[model samples]
Target: MDVDEERQRSLKRSLLCLCAAELVMMVNTTAFNVALPNIAESLGAGMAEQQWIVSSYNLVFAAVVLLAGFMGDRLGHLRTMIAGLGMFVVASAIGLAAGNVPVLLVSRSIMGAGAGVVIPMGQALLGILFRGPALSRAMTAWAIAGTLGVPFGPLVGGALTATLGWRGIFGFDGVVFLAVIAVIRMNVPRTGGSRKSRSLHVPWASVAMMFAGFTLFSAGLVNAQHGVLTAGAWMPMAVGAALITGFVLHDRASRNPLMELGLMRDPSFAACAPALMMLNFSMYGIIFIMPAYLETVLRHGALIGGMLLMPLVVASIAGARMNDRIVSRIGPRGTSLLALGCLAAGMLTIGAAMWWPDGMMRQSTVLVGQLMAGLGLGAGQPAMLTWAMGRVPIGQSGAGSSLLTVFRQFGSIIGVGIFGSIQSGLYTAEFHDLAQSAGLAPQSAGSVTLDFQRAADMTGMTGDLMRQAASRAYESAMTGSFAAAAAVIAATLGVVALISRRTPR
Candidate 1:
């Protein structure tokens, strides 16, 4: 074979290895969701603690991504990725050994940090390896791996948890990491010396401001679900707003800023960022609540719940692959609008399913809605990523991609915390009312409430009273979540429309 042909073959192999590494990272993120109840049961965790298991990982992941992106640029993507894989392997092992909630959470946070490093670096390497149509094809594959991981994680993790137990998921992750390490060592070519080490001087003030702002924004949304009207919630939200404002100003002023403010100013990035966040917010909100609705309200097992939800992931992979062709034909704006419409329609369909009379037919309706919703999400994601990153300078692709991932993570955090709180509050109130109506004694009513709460906590419940109450409450919560998601999608449509109008297509 010719030398150029050999080089091309080598590059393709490296990109595939990078994609494998990224898939491992993505699996770790969602694998824990299906295992949340099992983790809580084994650790004797409360709702707040279990929530932390998910949220803390996202919190650290989102917070460190910008920094990690810069490090990838300065430290050489290959070197940084190897280091990240090492951290991930260690973190997974620690999580496997964790005997308590705090230890598990700490492990998750470390894992998130490792992920934050690995993802952007892998994307950066891909960007460096391919160009033009080749670049697009490489990215299309990358996006598919990512989209597949979210849904596939739970399906596999559910099976693993049932068979080998929750801890086994971590062991699986460890094995995956070891395999990736071997691939990286063998296939990934060394791209010579690192760029001059960028000074490790983080803008402490800006970092503080960003965290405060995100925390406040998340807290406010969380409080809103509980009907809590307090200054504490609103205060942080306001403070967060001010902090973000200051952060932008600081970025503009800094000689070597952590993030490029100019990137945010790009029309494509600005428009696509919010749209991406909304897409994830809606997608995760559905993922978070739907399983509970299926298992507890419909009396399905973990296997069945996972199986019924398969359409979302399956359609997402299809949509992402199709997005490349769709973008070429319709352009980003038109394609995004069409995709968002599909998403809104899917959510509405799910809401309608809830309103339907309970029976096998309602279950079928819900399943159909989930399939449509998955299609919408899958279609939207790749187009959004392409539009956002395509507009940025090639050198800054790592930073831009990291920003997209960070916003998506933040959206997940916001979605789960807000939606979970809403579902919990509504379920608790409805269960209490139903128990009283059933003429149970006060003590019995309390016991019923406790059982309902346990079901919510476990993400499943089945009993005559518990089922009736849980069905009513879960239906209400799911409907509300869908409505909110629809509103967000509508807003995204407006944003993308404005962008299409201003920018020459």
Candidate 2:
């Protein structure tokens, strides 16, 4: 074959391999949402532990992403991606077969590490394979694969859970992971980049700092539910603050820092990072909390909740396509501001709907609000990422993009942990107050609390009183959580406004 034909064939194969890898990684992050309740039941997890199921994955994933990018630069993207895929496959198998919660957590953490390796390197490889419009289109396709995977995950996951069980999702992932490896091996070219003499070290100190900071913050939020405060919680938070301070200084002074601190000093890059962070924070919060609301409040099954989320996914895809057109016209700054406004408005609308009396109408109103939020998220995310990278030099694009990805994932971890805590706290407090107002004895109230917790584990309540109490507690908790999430989104809007105003137009 001629050179042109060979090049076209090579590009097609590489893009397909990249798309498969992207899809698997995205699915790994999102498919578990549908299984969370089932997982909790099986493991007998409380609110905090359940939150860890998601946060643990995101925490390790985000923490390691920067280092993964550095590894790709030194060790070759193809090699890094293949190794990640292998780890992902092993982790998936472990998760699928594990009988205990700790094992599952370990499996998830390993999966996150694998994801860290695959995603950044995959993007870097795409950069190597294509250029100009072809490159842009390829990258856009990757983004679409990843974003749409969130919505699609529930559909696939829910169906699998309904048909087979929660474990099926992980088993499916394992199979898909192997498929990705095969695709990469068969199709992707083995290209080599420069091996700079950068640190092969994993920056354990910085990782520990982030881990401590997030853990303390998450513990504080979780403790808020029990109406309890202890030194353990606050101490971690203080240490976290200190560690973060030290981390910043370390990054600045290190020859090859985990992150390039100087890039953050750029006003445009700085502004975009927070906006992207807030957007993902809100996105994951809704994803994490909405299913519970549907299951407990609306009396829907996992499949139904997944279906209800479909519109948001569809709107997001439409919004992402529209973003490409508008970014050139309004520029990234204006487009982002507009998107943020839409997000804030959408969140406020949902919050207002939650204040309505519980009914079908209230549910409908909230779903509308979700669609609006999804639209804003879809438009804002692509523009923010593209704009953030665009402002930096081509050579630094990987680092810049990786930083944004890290912050976004960190936002996801924080969002889930905080919102889960808020929901748990609100539920516990209101349930106790309601019991008192109903003239229940103190001993009876304690029994009711035990019953409620047990009801979450088992399928049915043996007594009418227990069922009624559990239902009230669950609804109250979900409503309070949604309201708090709305406030968080509102705070995000204010933050975006301040940041965008100062961002160079």
Candidate 3:
């Protein structure tokens, strides 16, 4: 083949492989939500354990990402990605054979480790392979794939779980994981990639500090269920804060910094990073609450919950597709403001649905809220990426981009932890109040509060009463939680509008 044609072919193949692999990884990030109830039932896990099941992967991913990036720089991005894929496959296998919650969590943490290695490495490889227009197009497609996978995860996961049971989801992942590995091997030529070719280095101390800091902070957030101010939550959070403070000092002093801290100086970048984080923050908060709410409070199956979320998935895709056109008319800042507004509005609408009696009107209202929030979140992402990256110093774009990714992950972890804490606390308080009013033992409230499914399964009027109380508690909790999330986004939106300079037509 001619050199030009071969180069084009190679680029196309590499881009295609990267996008598909990334889609699968991103899908797994949220897909496991569909299996939580079933997993809990089968393994006898409680609320805290279930939360960790969803959390462990994200925790591990945020913690280990820099180390993974360093490995990519040393061993070749493609090589690192493949090894990560291997880790993902094995983790899926472990998930399948696991008999207990701890074992399952161990498997998920491994998958998170895989994600850590693969995603950053994939981004690096794309940068290495493409330039200018090709690079831009590759990144857009890459971002879209990631965007679609998150909501799509629940859809695919639900279908798998409903048809094949919870283990089916893991089994399906294993199959797809193998296919991703196969596609990369078959399509990408052997001549591609390098081993230790460049001098991009990350210090081991920085890696350790970052991982520990992120992990501890998230762990503290996990304990926020007890109370954000309580010792269980605050103590760990204080230590984590200290460690993170130490990390900042160390990074500033070190010659080989893990992140491009300088990017924060750009007005657009500073606004863009936090704004994108709120998007994930809102998205993840909704994602975390809905699955448990559907499966536990409403007693719907995973498949039903997944089906209900279609409006969100569809709207997010539509918004992403419509983003460029929206930018052309209103500019990036307006588009971003519009996006956050929709998210805040959509969340409020979802919370409002609980006010209605159980019927079609309630469900339909929920769907509308999903559409609004999904559209806003989806619409803003492409613009955010393009805007932030444009301001990034050319040679340091990789580090800048990685920092943003870490930010997004941090947003996810925090959203889930804080929102989960909010829901749990409110649910328990309402349930306890009701249990006490009925003259039931406080011990009864403990199980009822922690495990909705168990409380729901008890026999007679007592069971029915607690069930009603549980449902009402969930409704009240979601209302408060959703409103809180909206308030945060709205406040952020206002700040961003003030800080970000108007985009030129």
Candidate 4:
């Protein structure tokens, strides 16, 4: 009956709506992984094209999010979010109607732009609504909504693709975002974009430099898998490194930098970026590879592969729900260290499973590893967000949150591009050798190695043998990839240790 209570209730509703909108964005990100095989099949995409399908969105998102964050601060969160959601709807329409690979990629990139704008403002709105304990709880809810999309994304995508078809997937996103726009218009309070002069400092140069740097770097990594020593691989990498250096120098010289480069000077906020990067590197890296492995190498349907990921998804949800409680009890440092340890253990376990000779047992081992990895990331990630954002000035919440997203997306690009390339290369080499040893001609064996369905077409007892050989090769490659990931995770653990020691008890 009181105005204050009524205001509080309305704010909560707005937060819930924003969380829901964010969930839609997160779902669009990973849901497409399950759909990639179907999309590739429909569009006749190759390995590089398939990887690009996933990476293109991430690359654009990472590059542009910082600008969006700054814009949200200057332009007003609600208004910026509406613009982003509108872009999402248009992109979804493009995706729904896309008849070829190039068009689909362009559509995905535009969707990434929308997401880059919307997501940071979602976090900024939470910062606007709550602080301290309430802030902690709000973040957990927001993170859970986003995290839910990760594990369940495949299942939702799989079912949609199987039942309604891949086009329906984009159709669903378009419909939800349209509804979200209506909700925002009706529910969210509006304010002017800027209280100060509207001539805000927008760093167009930084955007160009960062985008070029990440693009070249990722392209180089993808090329490395196929041609490790080629100019195509190393030259781009060198150029990328140079561009990134230029970006840092350029950003530092800017009167109002796109991101607070000074934030890295603070130990806790600094560590969070790398920690977030590795968390995604470990999480999305495996996720990027799994569907293809299950569908192509194991000859399972996309639905089955999606279903198999349920344990990982379930465990992640459980972990994210428990995050606030864990942080409350053990503190952020302890919580982060625990999560990092879980990630390392999980990756190592997956590596072991990949090394296992028995196929059935390997699947079980992978499931267990997924559980550990999911829980680790789900719990630790919120803590990183909490700790990092807690240090940010409230006025710049959008910028801070967007920087965090940039790091995460950057990691995703690295994880998918590099890991996929490595897995593909290793599998190619092993499958080629095995096919020749099976008495097949090198050319025929080479052709089969190039195409997944052809490998499946080998029939009867010989076909079974060939399939088994290919599976072993894939497993070996996957194990190697997991092991490498585990090493990266271990380094992440070291970073957590530094934060843990400095964090107050």
Candidate 5:
């Protein structure tokens, strides 16, 4: 074979390794959802703690990723990736040994920082290796790898948690990343230490502003569980909004903005970006809500909960397979409307299922809804993604992509934070009333309300009352959360419908 052919084969191997690394990152993001209940049981975590343990990572990741591209450019993509992987390996070790909630949260945030660095650098490396047709194909592989983690994450997480316990999730990430790092050292061709680019500008102020804004914003929303009227809830929210506004103004005024804000001026992009955001919101919300419900409320084991999500998984893949053909028939606009409708319908159905008998009927309804929702998002999401990206000017595609990612990641944060706050509030109100009606003492009911596993383990009439109230409260809260997801999807549908006519075919 010619030298070029051998080079091509080696590049493909490198691509595989890089994509595998990314898949590990994505899986770690959602896999913890299945383990949240276990974590809570082990650590005595409340609603806020549970949400932050997950959101802390996302908040840092979303905030850091914008700046990570610059880091890659400065440090050299390969070198930056190695450093990030090393941090991830160390953070995962910390997570494995975490004895309490605060420590675990700190560990997750560090992991998020590593992921923020690794992902963009991984993409940068791909850009270096593949050009023209190969570049597009390589990116498509990268995108697919990221997508697969969402549906399969719970299953993988569930299996790990069941077999090796919750810490296994962290252990798995650490082990894989270490192996990937080793492979990169051995197989990936190294250029010299990467040099900083002369033309590139790093917006340190914008980075700090954006990061602070999101953190404050998400913190405020999560704090709303205490009551939106409280100082804790509204104060940070006000400041966060101010900071975010400042971020935008700063970006607009800056000569070298962190992102291409003008991409939204195109009607298609304006509509498509939020559609992607809402899609992210929907995905994050469901994964966050479901696992704890299945594991704690319904008394299903982690493995069973993971297995239960398979229909949604299978259907989503099928929907994705059909995305292109549907777009061919109805166009991207029509395709998105259909997908959002199905997504909303599924969420509503899940809400409705709680009213049914708590045995097979409830389970079947949720499963059916999962299939419907899964198919909708699966079929619809790629179309929206394609539509949004297609509208970007070739010259500005990188910045456009970054801005879209920021929107999508924030959407995930909003989903987790807002829904978490809402769920906490609903559960508290419902449990309070139920506890009062049962004549239970405030302290016992408070403990039960804080964590479902405690109620499951208690004894006697009080235990029975606690169990029932906890279960009922969780169900009620979940119902409300699903309803909110449906409402968001509905609003997104309205927005998209308004723009569909204006959207370029």
Candidate 6:
């Protein structure tokens, strides 16, 4: 083979390896949610601890991910990825050995740090690796890796938790990281920094503000379960908002901002922000709530819940593969509108499913909704990202990719938090009335309410009457949450409609 052919083969191998690592990163992120229940039981964790367990990683991930992309740009994508993999491996090992909630939370936060670095670097590197049609295909695979991770996470987590216990999930992650590291070392080519990269200074003030803002915002949102008026629910959010505002002002003034603030000037890039946010808001919102819904209302086991969720993952992968052709034929705007419509329809379907008393009907309807939502997100996200990137210069792909990733992650943070609050609020209100009508004493009612407070786990409700009430309350709460998601999708569709076709392709 000629030297050019040899180099092409190596690049393909490297892309595959990087994609594999990306897949594993997603698996680890999503699988942890499935394992949370098991971890709570094993470690005797409280409701607050469980919330932290899940949100810590996300909080940390969102805080540092932007910086990770800059590191990839300045240092090297491959080197950053390797560092992330090594950190992930160590973090997983720590999680496997964790004897308490704090240790596990620390481990998860560390893992998120690694994943934050890895995720943006992977996307940045992919931009560097391919061009034109090849870039489209590579991004399709990348999108598949991401969307596949969401549903597959529960599947893998359920299987691992059922068979080898929750620790097995962490152990599996460690193994995946190790294998990916080997592939990275063998296949990926080294990339040098740009000449102008050294002149670019890291905006430490903006970084701190961004990190503090997200962390506090997350803390506040997670605390919303306490009640919207409570200090836990609003104070941190207030502080976070202020910090984020400060960051925006600082970024506007900086000579070399962390991300290209000017990208929003392009209509296509501007649209991608909320468009991707809404996509993830719908997708992750459901993923956040479904495991509990499956186990509680439908009374499915973890493994079975995972199996039922498989159609979503499978459909997402199919949608991503089909998107390239669809966009080419229908144009980007048409494809986007259709995807948004599908998402709105899916949310409505799921909401309707919640009202059904019959198990078979509810499951089937939910399955259909899952498929629709997955396909919509799978198609819409890749198109939005591609469109946004087209507007970006090749030199700034890392920053561009980072901004996109942060938008998605930000959406996830808000989606999960908002949905959880909706469910918890609705469930609490409904359950109280149900419990009172059931003629339980105030003390008994309080205990039962506390048991179902998180709205994620129904294990504590023992008697048939309590279980029945819990299920009914859960179903109602989920319906309200789904309706909220549908509204978000509809609103996003309206925003997408405003983007003119005259924008650069």
lDDT of 4 by residue, 57-156 (tens): 8888888788888788888988998999998899999999899999999999999889888888888777777788778888888878888877778888
Name the runs in model 4 displaced over 4 angstroms. Answer: 191-198, 441-450, 456-466
Query: Which of candidates 1 and 3 is the stronger one according to TM-score?
Result: 3
Better of 4 and 5 by TM-score: 4
Residue 221 local lDDT, model 4? 81
List candidate 3 segments past 4 Å from native. Answer: 1-10, 73-75, 127-136, 188-202, 393-397, 438-452, 502-505
lDDT of each: 0.71, 0.71, 0.77, 0.80, 0.78, 0.78
Question: How good is model 1 by TM-score?
Answer: 0.90
Residue 337, candidate 2: C-alpha displacement in angstroms: 2.2
Q: In model 5, where do residues sit more than 4 Å from their true spots?
A: 1-15, 72-83, 120-143, 182-201, 391-398, 442-451
- Screening candidate 1 with a backbone cut-off below 3 angstroms (N, C-alpha, C), the clashing residue pairs are 316-378
lDDT of 2 by residue, 315-428 (tens): 777777787677768877887777777776676666567566657777788778878887887788767766566555545545665677777876786678666777676666
lDDT of 3 by residue, 2-52 (tens): 999988988898888988998999788778887777776777766667678
lDDT of 6 by residue, 361-397 (tens): 9878988998898889789867777777767776777
Model 2 clash pairs are: 225-425
- How good is model 2 by TM-score? 0.89
Whole-model lDDT, candidate 1?
0.71
lDDT of 1 by residue, 1-505 (tens): 9999999999889978987887777667766776765565577664456556776776777777777776666666778778888877898899889998888988888887788778877777776777666777777777778777777777877787888888889899888898998899899976522465456565667667676666666666555544546775566666766876787688779887878668877777787777777676766677666755654456564556666677778888888778878879988777777888888788877877777775777777777877777777777776777677677665676677678777777777777777666666565566567656764321222212235445454433234555566467667666776776677677777876786666546
Better of 2 and 4 by TM-score: 4
Best by TM-score: 4
TM for every model, in the order presented, reads 0.90, 0.89, 0.91, 0.94, 0.88, 0.93
Higher-lDDT candidate of 3 and 5: 5
